[model samples]
Target: MTWFLISIAALIGGYFIYGTFVEKVFGINEKLATPAHAQNDGVDYVPMSTPKVYLVQLLNIAGVGPIFGPIMGALYGPAALLWIVIGCVFAGAVHDYFSGMLSVRNNGASVPTITGRYLGNGAKHFMNIFAIILLLLVGVVFVSAPAGMLTNLANEQGGLEISKTTMVVAIFAYYIIATIVPVDKIIGRFYPLFGALLIFMSVGLITAVGFSSEHTIMGGYAISDMFTNLNPNDMPLWPALFITIACGAISGFHATQSPLMARCMKNEKNGRFVFYGAMIGEGVIAIIWCTLALSFFGSVDALSDAVHNGGPGNVVYSSSFGLLGTFGGILAFLGVVILPITSGDTAFRSSRLILAEYFNMEQKSLNKRLLMAVPLFVIGAILTQVDFGIIWRYFGFANQSTATIMLWTAAAYLLRHNKLHWICTVPAVFMTTVCIAFIMNNATLGFGLPMTISTTIGIVSALAITAYVVKVSKGKGDTELADEEKPKSAPETV
Candidate 1:
C-alpha cells in the first residue's frame, strides 16, 4: 500500500508541474488565475516554480506522523491499509487540492476566508474555531513525536538521558533558521538534494531488512502475528484506526500549505498541478514509510516493544538503521532530525501567516510575534509533558474531520459551477464516507468521543456550508462572478 501510494503521488507531483507550465496552451486566461492580496515581501510570498512548491508541500506534509501512524495502524492488520489509501486519494488529497485552489482564486485566503466567501459569516466563524482547535491538536502531537524520537536516539547511541533542554535548544535553532531562510532558495537548491539522500538511506534500510535471515514467517503470517499478539490492554482497532488516519490522512496543516503555495502560482490553471499534484506526492511518501515499518519490523509486537521499552524513535531507528551498519544508523538519525526541521519550518511559517491574517496584523510586527509566541510556547510545553502516541491519535482524528469538511465545501462549489467532473469528486466522497465510518467505529469501541464529536460537528458544518455556497452561486449567476486575480507577467530574459 505504501509503495503504491508513493508511486501515485510522485506521478501526480510531476503532472502538476507539467500542467502548470502548459496553462497558456489550455486557454486558461487571467480571469481564472489565483488572486494575490496582502502580499509579503519577505520569505512567505516568494514566487516559486510548480516543482519547488511541490517539494515544499511534500516536505511539509511528510513528517513523523506518517511513520508512526501507519506503524501503529498496522495493529488492525492489513485491513487498515484500506482506509489509509482510500482516505489519502479521496478525502486527504482532494481536500488539500481544492482548498488550495479555492484559496488561490480568492487572493490567497486561508480556508476560513474561502469558507466565508462561499459558506457565510457564521460558517466562517465555525470553520476558524474548528481549524484552530485542529491546528493545536496537530502541533502538540507532531512536536512530541519528534522529541520522543530524539530522546530515543540519545538513549541508544550514548546510553545517556537526553535532556529536554537540548531538545528545546535544537528545536529553537531550527525554527530560527526556518524563519530567516527563503523557501524558494531552499527548495531550489537543497530540497531535492536532501530528498535524494533521504530516499537513498531509506532504500538501503529497506534492502537490509528484506535480506535478513532472522525470524521469517511464510504467507504474511509474521505481519499478522504481530497484530494479533499485541498486549490486549493497548488501544483497540476501531479507535487506533481512527487515530491513525487522523494523524496520517488529511490535516489542517495542509490548509495552511495550500494558501501559501496558492499565492506562488502564476495562474489559476496551475491549481490542478500544484494543489492536487503535491497531495499525490505526500500519499506516496506515506506508503513508503508504511511498507518500511511492516517489512522491517515483521510484527506490531516488535514495534510496540521498541516503543515501550526503547521508545518509538528506537523502533524507527532500530528498524531503519539497524539494517545498516553504525554509519547507516547515524545517517538515519540525522535524517530523522532533518525531517522535523523541514516540517516544523513549514508549520511555523504557515501558522504565522494564518495568525497574521486572522488578527489583521503586520507579518513582521511585534504584535504578530506576541500572538505567535504564546501558541508556540504552549505547544512546546505540552510536547515536554505529553505521551506523543496518544497525542498523535487525537491529531489524526481532528485532521481528518477538517479535511472531511473542506471536501464537502469543494464538492458543493464544483457542483454549483457545473465543474464537478473536472474536480476530483470521487476522492472527496470516499474520504467523507470513510471518515464518518471511522468516527462511528471509534464511538462503538469506547474511545473518548472527542474526535468523533468533532467529526460529527464537521459533517454538519460541511452540509451547511455546501448549502450556503449553492444558494449564493444561484443568486449570482456563475458568469457574473469576478475573475480570479493573476500575477504580473514575468520579465523577458535580456
Candidate 2:
C-alpha cells in the first residue's frame, strides 16, 4: 500500500507544484477576455463555471481507457505505478494544460487549426484527418461495447430482454442529441451528475481496498522490480507498457478533448484546475485499478491469466463485483458504462467543432450544426458494423503520435516567445522515440525490425526533429508582453 499512497500523493502534488509552474510559464491573464465571453454563441462557445468545466473535461477525456488500460498494464507488475506517476506529472498533465490553454489563447480553435499555426499547414492538415478518424473510431467502439453489456444485463434480468441492435440505436440516439444540442442544454446540465457517479465509483473501490485484510496491494512493488517487465507473456515494457497505459499516463486523445472545454471556460487561470488537475484525477483512478488488479487476484500471473481469457473488461467486472457487493457492483458497472458513453458523446461533439472550424462555417444555426454532425454519425453507424479489432490496435499508436506532436507544439509556443522550451521538448523527444520503436519492432504494424536497429533509428529520428524545431523557432520571438495580454490570432488564419 505504500507505493499506492505515494503515487496518490505524487499526483496531488503535481497539480500544486508543476501545474502551477506550467500555468506561470504560459502566463495566465485573468483580465483578458476568453473565447467563451469574446465569441459567445450559446451553442458551443458559452461561458461556464470553472467547476462545471472541470467535471465535463474530466469525463470528456476519460473513456474506459484509464480503467481497462491500467488493469492490462498491471500485468507488468509494479512498473505500471511508476509510469502512471512520472508520465502523468511530466507528460500527460502538461500536454493537456497546453492543449486547453493554447486553444484559449487562440480563441478556442480546434487542435488541428492550432497545430497549423505552430507546426505548419502540413501538420494541420494531417491532424485534421487524423483527429476525425480517431474520434470516429472512439465513438463507434464505445457504442458497441456498452450496447453489448447493456444488452446482456437487460436480457439477464427476470422479465425483460433487449437486443444489441436496440441498445445500439438507443445509444446512437443519445450521442446525436448530445452532439447537436447547445453546450448548456445537455452536456453542461447532465455531465456533473455523470461525473459524480464516476467519482463515487473510484472513491468507494479505493476505500474498500484500503480497509481490506488481503495482502498489501502495494507490497509487491520493490525497487528491484521497478524496471523489470513481469508481463507473463513477455511483452517488452519499453513500448508495450507505455502504449498500454496511454490514458492514465499520456494520451493524445486527451489533447483533443481539451479544446472542447477551452471554448466553455470563463477564465484562463482555471486551465490548471480544469485541464491539468483532471489528468491527475485520471491518474489516481488508474493507480487504484492497477493496485486492485495486482492484488485482488493474488498475483500478477493470475491477473494475466484472467486478462488473456476474457480481456480487461472481464477483469474489471469480476474485481468490482468481488470486492464490493451487489449494490456496489451495479454502480461499478454503471461507472464503466457511463465512462465510454460520456466520452463518446464528446468525441462526436469535438468532431463537429473541428469540421466547423476547418470549413470556416458558423455553427449557431441548427442546420449548420447538423450539416457538420450528420455525416459524422452516418459514418460512425457504418463503422459499428465492421470488425474493429485490428483498427483498435492502431489507436494507441495514433494517440501517442498525436501527443508527441502536441508536446512539440507546446515547446514551439515557448520557443517563439523565448521562454523555457525544454519542458515539452524532452518528453516530446522521448515519446517520439517510443512511437517510432513501437511500430518498427512490432510485426503487425511495421517491418518488424530488430530491437537494436529500431531503437537506433528512433533515437536518430528524435535528434533530427529536435534540431529542425529549434532551428526554425529561433528569431521568431514575439513580444511576450503583448502576446500574453492580447494573444495571437489563431482561428483567423484558418
Candidate 3:
C-alpha cells in the first residue's frame, strides 16, 4: 500500500516537477499561431480545444500497449514498477513531448521528415519506409485483437452468431472510413463516449485494487527488490524486461502517434498537457495493471501461471470480472477493446498523412486521399495473412528501435539550437544499448551471443552513437524557419 501510494504520487509529481522543466526547455510560445490556425486545412489541421486534443492524444498513444505491455512486464515482479516510474518521467514522456512540440514547431511534419531534418536525407528515406511499415504492422495487429475479442463476446455474451473473419472485414471497413474522413467527423464525434469508458475502466480497476484485502499493495515491492532479480523465467533485466515492458515505459510508436495530434493543437501551451501529460496518464494506467498483476493473485508465481495459461488478455478479463463484477467487467473489457480500435484507425490515418507529405499530395481532394489509402489497406490486408506470432516478435523491437532514433532526433534538435542536449542524449545512449544487447543476445534475431559479450558490444555501441550525435549536432543547420522549409499553404495529412 505504501509503495503504491508513493508511486501514484510520484507519477503526478513528475508532471509538475520534471514536466515543467521540459516545457521550459522547449520554450512554448502561447501567442504563436499554431498550424490549426496558420494552415487551417479543415481536415487534419482542424483546430481542437486543449482538453480535446489531450484526450485524443491519450487514446491515440495508449492502445493495448499500456494495458498489455505492463501486465507482461509485471511478470518481473516489483522491478517493473521502477521502469514505469523512472522511464515515463525522464525518457518516455520526454520522447513524447519533443515529438509533439517539434512537430508543432515544424509545420506538423511527420516523423520521417522531422528525423530527416535532424539526421539527414539518408535517414529521411529510411524512416519514410520504416515509419509506414511500422504503422501498417500496427494496423494489422490491432485488427486481430479486437476482431477476435468481439467475435467471442458476441457469440458467448450477445448470443449473436458471428464470425472472426466477418469481424475482421468489418473492422477494416471502419478503418478505411476513419482514415478517409475528416478528423472531426468520426473521431471527434465518438471520443467523448470512448473517453468515458476509458475513465470508467481505469478508475474502477484501481479503486478495486486499493480496497481489496486479499493482498497488500506493498506485495508489489520489496526491500531486497533493489538487488535481487526475481524473474521466474530466468530472463535478465538488461533487455528482456525492457522489451516486455515495451511502451509502458518508452516506445517509438508514440513518436508516430504524436504528430497526429500535433497538427490539431489549438495553442503551443497545450503541448505539455497533450503530449507529456498523456504519457503520464498512460504510466498511471500501467502502474495499476502492474500492481493488479502483483497483488490480485497474491504472489508473482500465481500471476505468472495465469499469464502462462491465458496470457495478458486473460489477466485483464479475470481481474476485471473478479473485481468489478460481470456487468461492469464487460464494459471494462469493451474499454480494453476500444483502446486498440482507436489507435488502429489512427495508425492508418497517420500512414496516409505520412504518404501525403512524402509525395506532396494534397489531402483536400477525396481522390488523392483514396489513392494513398487504397494501396495501404491492400498491404495491411495482405499482412493479416502472415503468422501473427512472427509479426509480433518484431513489433516490440521495432518499437524500441524507432524510439532510440527519435530520442537521438530530439538530441539533435536540441544540439542544433545549442540548448541542453543531454536530456535526450542520455536516454538515446541507454536505449541504443538495450536495442543492441537484445538483438545480439536473442537467439531468434542476431548472433545469439553470450550475455557477457552482448552487453559489452551494446555499451561500446552506445559510446559510438554518442560521438556521432555530437558530430551531427556540430554540422550546419538549415537557415530558414521549419514552416518556411515547408509550403506556405500546406495543409496537414489525415
Candidate 4:
C-alpha cells in the first residue's frame, strides 16, 4: 500500500515539476498562430478548447494499452509500479510533450514527416511506411477486440444478440464517419462523454481498494521485489516488462497520436496540459487498474492464474464485474468494449491524416477524405479477419520500435537546436538497445540467445548510436536546422 501510494503521488507530482520544466524548455509562445488557426479547414484542422483536446488526447493514447499492458506486466511483480512512475514522469511524458509541440511548431506534420526533417529523407520514408502499418494494425486489433467482447457480453446477457460480424460492421461504420467528418463534429462532441466513463471507472476502482479491509489483497512482496522478475514463467525484466507495459511507460504510438491533437490545439501552452498531463493521467489510471487487479485477486499468483485461464479481457471482466457487481459490470463494459472502440476509430482517423500528409494531398473536400479513407478502411476490414493474437504480438514489437524512432528523432531535433539534446538522446539510446534486445532475444524471431550475449550487444549498439549522434551534431548543426522545419520539401544533405 505504501508503494502504491508513493507511485500515485510521484505521477501527480511529476506533472508540476518535470512536466513544467519541460514546458519551460520548449518555450511555448502563445502569440504564434497554431496550425488550427493558421489553416482552419474545419474538417481536420479545427481549434478546440484545451480541456476537450486534453480529454481526447488522453483517451486516444490510453486505449487498452495502459490497462491491459500493466495487468500483464504485473505478473512480473511490482516492477510495473516503478516503471509506470519513473517512465511516465520522465521518458513517456517528455516524448509526448515534445512530439506534440514539435508538430504544433511545424504546422501539425505527422511523426514520419517530422522524423524526415530531423533524421533524414531515407529515415522519413521508412517511418512513413512503418507508422501506417502500425496504425492499421492498431485499428484492426482495437476493432476486433471490442467487437468480440461486446458480442460475448450480449450473448451472456441473453438479450439483443449482436453477432461479432455485425458489431465489426457497425463499429467500422462509426470509424468511417469519425474519419471523414470535421474534427469538432463527432469526435469532439462524443469523446468527453467517453472520457467521463473512463475517469469514473478509475475512481470507482480506487475507492473500492482504499476502503477495503482485506490487507491480504495489498500485502505480500513489497515494491522492491519488482527489481527482479517474479513471474513463474521467469520472463526477463529487460524487454518483456518494457514492451508489455508500453502505454503506462513509453510508447511510440503516442507520438503518432500527438499530431492529431497538435492540429487542434488553440495554444502552445496547452501542450503541457494536453500531452504531458495526459500521459500522467494515464499513469494514474494504469496504477489504479494494476493495483485493483492485484488486490481483487489477493495475490500476483492468482492474478497470473486468471490471466492464463482467459486473457487480459477476462481479468478486466472478472475484476470489474466480480468486485463492483452491477456497477462493475458497466465499468467492465466500458473498459472491455467502449474505450477500445474509441481508440480504434481514431487510429483509422490518424492513418487518414498521415496518408494525406504523406501524399501532399488536399483533404478539404469530402471526396478527398473518402479517397484517402476508403482504401485504408478496406484494408483494416480485411485485417480484422486475421487472428487477433498474431496482430497483437506484432503490434507490441512495432509499437516500441516506433517509440525508439521518435525518441531518436526528437534527440536529433534537440541536437540541431543546440538545446540539451541528452534529454531525448539518453532515452532514445536506451530504447534502441531494448528494441534490438527484444528482436535478438525473443523466442519467435531470434535464436533465443543467452541474456549475457544479448545484453552485451544491446549495450554496444546503444553506445554506437549515441556516439554517431554526437559526432554528427557538431559538424552539421546549421544543415540539420534547415532540414528540421521543412516537412514537405526534400531534406537537405547533412
Using Cα atoms with residue i matched to residue i, what is each candidate's TM-score against the true structure? Answer: 0.79, 0.95, 0.95, 0.94
Instruction: Quote the positional error of residue 189 for candidate 2 in Å.
Output: 0.5
Clashing pairs in 2: none
The residue-by-residue lDDT of candidate 3 on 210-298, one tens digit each, is 78776566565576773466778877877888877767689888999999888888777788899999999989888888888877887
Candidate 2 wrong stretches, greater than 4 Å: 156-160, 214-216, 219-223, 479-484, 487-494
Ranking by TM-score: 2, 3, 4, 1
> Can you write out model 1's per-residue Cα lDDT over 408-444, one digit (the tens) per residue?
5665566555554234344444455545646655654
What are the per-residue Cα lDDT tens digits for candidate 4 across 112-191? 99888777898889999999999999899788888877786777655776789998999899999998999889888989
On lDDT, the leading prediction is 2
- Where does candidate 4 have its weakest 10-residue lDDT segment? 485-494
lDDT of 3: 0.84
lDDT of 2 by residue, 72-142 (tens): 89999888999999999999999999999999888898899878878779889999998998888889878
| lDDT measured at residue 391 in model 1 versus the true structure, 0 to 100 | 56
- lDDT against the true structure, each candidate: 0.58, 0.86, 0.84, 0.82
Cα misplacement distance, residue 64 of candidate 3 (Å)? 0.6
Misplaced by over 4 Å in model 4 are 158-160, 213-217, 475-494
In what order do the candidates fall by lDDT, top score first?
2, 3, 4, 1
How far residue 119's Cα lies from its native spot in candidate 1, in Å, is 1.6
